[model samples]
Target: MPAGGLDIRTFDAVKALAFIGDLSMGQPTDHSLRTAWLAAQIAGAASFRADICDTVREASLLRWSGCTANAAEFTNTFGDDVEGRAAMLAERPDWAELLNAQGGPAQAIAPLAQIHCEVSGEVARILGLGSETEATLRHIFETWDGNGMPNQLNGKAVPAAVFVVALAGDLEIFSRVYGLEHALVLIAHRANFRYPATLTIPVNTHAAQWLDTLAQLAPAALDAALLTPQMQHSTSPDLIADVLDLKLPWMTGYSRAVATTAAACCARLVADPEASERVYRAGLIHGIGRAAVPNAIWDTPTRLSAAQWEKVRLVPYWTSRAGKQMGTLDQATELASYAYERLDGSGYFRAVGGPALGLEARILAASAAWVALRSKRPWRDALSDVAASELLRTEAEQGRFDSDVVEALLEGEPTATQSASPRNIRYAAETTRLSSREIDVLNLISHGASNKEAARALNLSPSTVRTHVERVFRKLECTTRAAATLKASAMGLLR
Candidate 1:
């Protein structure tokens, strides 16, 4: 049984989030999944205990959790070259070579590596992982010869699972990119220097068979295979959200804050326990999709162009997709995807309206907006609570937000000072240049409503609705509903 009576589903959810880590590292979508599978197999072949196998698998999947915070540093030093960075990492360069190649001083590399390891370990702790797993993650890059970047533990001093994972990760990558024989060669070359001889010997002996097993493995099958009954103690959804929130400096603690505030609001509204929990979960991961966008875009201190804004709008869609990968989180994920939507059908990724938007989604949106207003952005300072409330009230009054949701958010807050009005706040004005009717038609189409259904809803003839949609496409400089929706969302035309 899981310690603390936590559900096994929590582990399943964490495994799913590993895919996001893979993306952040610029690897294939299933890189983490494959790494975990390979690591577990290597552990089993080496006769590791069942618990050790489980820890290895978990550690391998989450080894890159620290990359979210370190990506900007990598980009700044390496200039967005994924393959180059991969090559540099594969060579296992010393601190001097790494800094020299990246055009940074040798002194800067140690602190960066240390920060990455510490952050990864912290995330593991927050997720309730065992200390062994956390230690393995922290020492993931440490080598057998005591020449690793963060720590220089030699031979047996390195954590067993970390050694196993380091070899397994490279095995999967080389085997996939090169071939089975080449992967074995690479392992042999690095043996006794980067990986333990005991682990690498078994891998060398059964290279072909191991590669065969991994070749047949699929990303979707990973969770069922790795998350065995004994593999308990999964991280809660809220903690998973926090892991994603760490990706941006501005977004730190944003997800947890939203989840807590939203859950409290749900309780105040007298929602049932289930409803409150669902909203809380949704709030926790509402920004999970933000990972798909680059940190450069997120950290930019200027207005986003139309294309960049479209990328921002699709974050919620990506979050929903990530959530859907876990069987138990489907509902919460769906609500999270709607976090950027509005009551008046002004959301991006999907232009949903009042009828289609659920109460949980409304509360999630309200809470996210409230938290964001209070948090500092690259372009602006954090808003005072009263100022945020006033801005949210203005949004509600304009029909972009639900009045009830806004009221619930502001019930206990002090009134805004006179200086906090819209006239004083620097708002990103709507620039999509779409008329109200065009926006209406776009919203209907976004919800997958047929032209006839849209006509019925808007009380117009099918011909009129079609004309309006066509004009929306033309005006937005797009040819399809999907493109138009994205563009409009990026333009901030949607609520």
Candidate 2:
């Protein structure tokens, strides 16, 4: 077993994330787990090697990891009913037919598929899956007839494990949604095109038995049974954080940075070792809920609608729920759930404030604010150390942020420089169309500044500030200050 007690439980934790991925894709929570279980059963029927069967199971559970990263693009192209549509498409044998039916051009869908595959491979690597497993995941959609997205590997060119997962995933869905006979017919029809004949034969022969066994086993029991010793793997808080951060390009290293800074603050505040560790872990996974939100919102340079803002607020709540599902992460997840909360009860998901917010939560909030300020975002440039510190102090004075926590963060690193690299800064600027002045107005407004205060801060007239605010609102498609702030924060535009 690897150090830190990850062991087989790590696989369970990954499966939990896959469960979240299922929800993100608009499927039932057990969708990925059921797929993994079904895939393993099919692999067993095919008499595949033990290691290959394991890979098939892992790949099946994680097949949709990329979907979190590409959800915005998918929703924008396909519509808000992505889950139903995606399920429908998955049942179809022809990818080209589905795309044509959806009125999505192949050229547009191709890059999305490539990104999805690449991100899936990255998740596999981060979770320490072997090269074979990683490769299988990358080629999960490649068809037997060289007609799949991202890559068109034909026949034996596609990984055998991937073929097993492909057939099993479809079989599970079809069998569950339709009857066994109809599922068999669908499998037979797609035998030579969607899945290789070799794999399809085994699936067709044992489809009923596999379906019956899956139906008999409880999802929890199935998960427990699959956590065999050999499935154990090494993982750490950083690895998990990377997986969550992969949901958005702009949030690439946000979690790790927050964890690092939060740990430092905890140390400076003389927190117990356990408290420090818990806070660090909490900071790392605090944004796990981000995966549930569409990237279009994260990437939107403009303001979000009130409906969109509602989705943004629930991210922390989702993170808490996800943590609760993992037996080992209950405490840390609770802390993470408070990462977005403010001392003044203005925070979201749960509006608990003041005494309800503990020391650890305060440190997390301060550290998160500090890190975000130092990171480049689409609406504004990274704040200078002096400016960020001043902002924190100002918020504290207004009873919104914790003054002691803010001081602890500042004292933890008196000379800390901005951590946003030049490349990231450039990337943020390039992807956003907001001008520096407009960004300035938005930033002030996000912090609860009225037009007059914003005007004074930027050395402009109140009327000019109002005009800038209107322009910002118009560009962002928002009607209220709260909506603008929520939208800006979702896009990583706020500290």
Candidate 3:
């Protein structure tokens, strides 16, 4: 995005992401946190360095982080991706037998593994976890044996942290899903294949004790343990937004679009920059709980059953749960979780309406509804601009959405071939982390201005122009001048 970025604590983001992975994989909440706790204990027994222990913990939490990337494929391979995976992780003998079958789960593993590896690796990088953690995640699917997806590195070629994380993850997952005795048997059988035997010994020795200690922790205590403070990542919170969109192909860029539009609407609604900023962020993560639902449910063409609709309603509840685990992010996440709530008290998760809703929350709810109306979904084609506008206003009239907030969303709809909407540009810059002055420079450059030309247009020195241009290129993930121009144009930053 050409807009500004939000700052989130590295652990906070990672913990939220871990929860997403757990949900997608059909595991209990804090499954990853439990795994991390187990892994850290194992690392301590082994006397690994604090940094290596940290790597082990992060890798364990993120092992399944790429589950969403391959969710659609998993749904196609297995009848239900979530339930199928939960069953696959059960401690039966040769439980992954179907995973190796020809044209069965085997055919999908290669591509799915690659997708998972790349996505999890990106998460590791965004959190600024060093090369060790990143490498561990990239090969998280690989086994101690030479058989793995994408890359087939075996033995020492795989990161040492991978084996540790694997052992710990299996301990948490298998024990809960298949009982301790069965889980231990499965872990023992995987000795050299799943992980080296030396690694298995300590786990076998302390497995029960570790699990008992984990079970002893109260819910609040467990949450406190997982939400430990850490250095904040200076990147955009949109990374999680992008990850959420990945679960459904049709949803690509939907979150960012909502974020930009909601911020723009907030600007129209009130003069509070802080309110605008919070609403924009809420827009970005409004669908954070979508990971818990299967793609089959999301991509269903037919009308959903009562059970399915019930699941849909709990989506916001899950998002709220995720927020509760993340320290200090309650406000924005709370606003986001209210995306489906209606002003008429007809929404899911919570039905309170009218006075209970604040201005920023109203903006997010209206923004999400408006954006979803404009975008295509499996059940329906996207509405035309005028049709969507009429429907939004009509819903407001019926008290489903706040009328004033709906008005703000409709204000200044941009023309297709003409200049981008100034309201949009302002929000984009703010949410994308660019300053007003930078937008001015980008505007000049987008219209084919040279460095000196941009400087002249903005009344700045050539050095300053060069600086802003470089920053824009970096922020937009473009290298060449043409690339920057094209990206800026897409972002509505160009004139």
Best by lDDT: 3
As a TM-score, model 1 comes out at 0.73
Model 2 clash pairs? 302-476, 303-476
Worst 10 residues of 2 by lDDT: 417-426
What does the lDDT come to for candidate 2?
A: 0.71
Query: Candidate order by TM-score, highest to lowest?
Result: 3, 2, 1
Q: Candidate 3 versus the native: TM-score?
A: 0.81
Which candidate number maximizes TM-score? 3
Q: Model 2: residues >4 Å from true position, as ranges?
A: 1-9, 68-98, 101-106, 174-186, 197-220, 228-230, 414-495
Residue by residue across 20-66, what tens digits does model 2's lDDT show? 57656666667777888888887887898988888888888888876
lDDT of 1 by residue, 6-68 (tens): 222656566656756766766776677778888888899999998889889888878877666
TM-score of each: 0.73, 0.73, 0.81
For candidate 3, write residues 229-254 as lDDT tens digits.
23344444655665676676567557
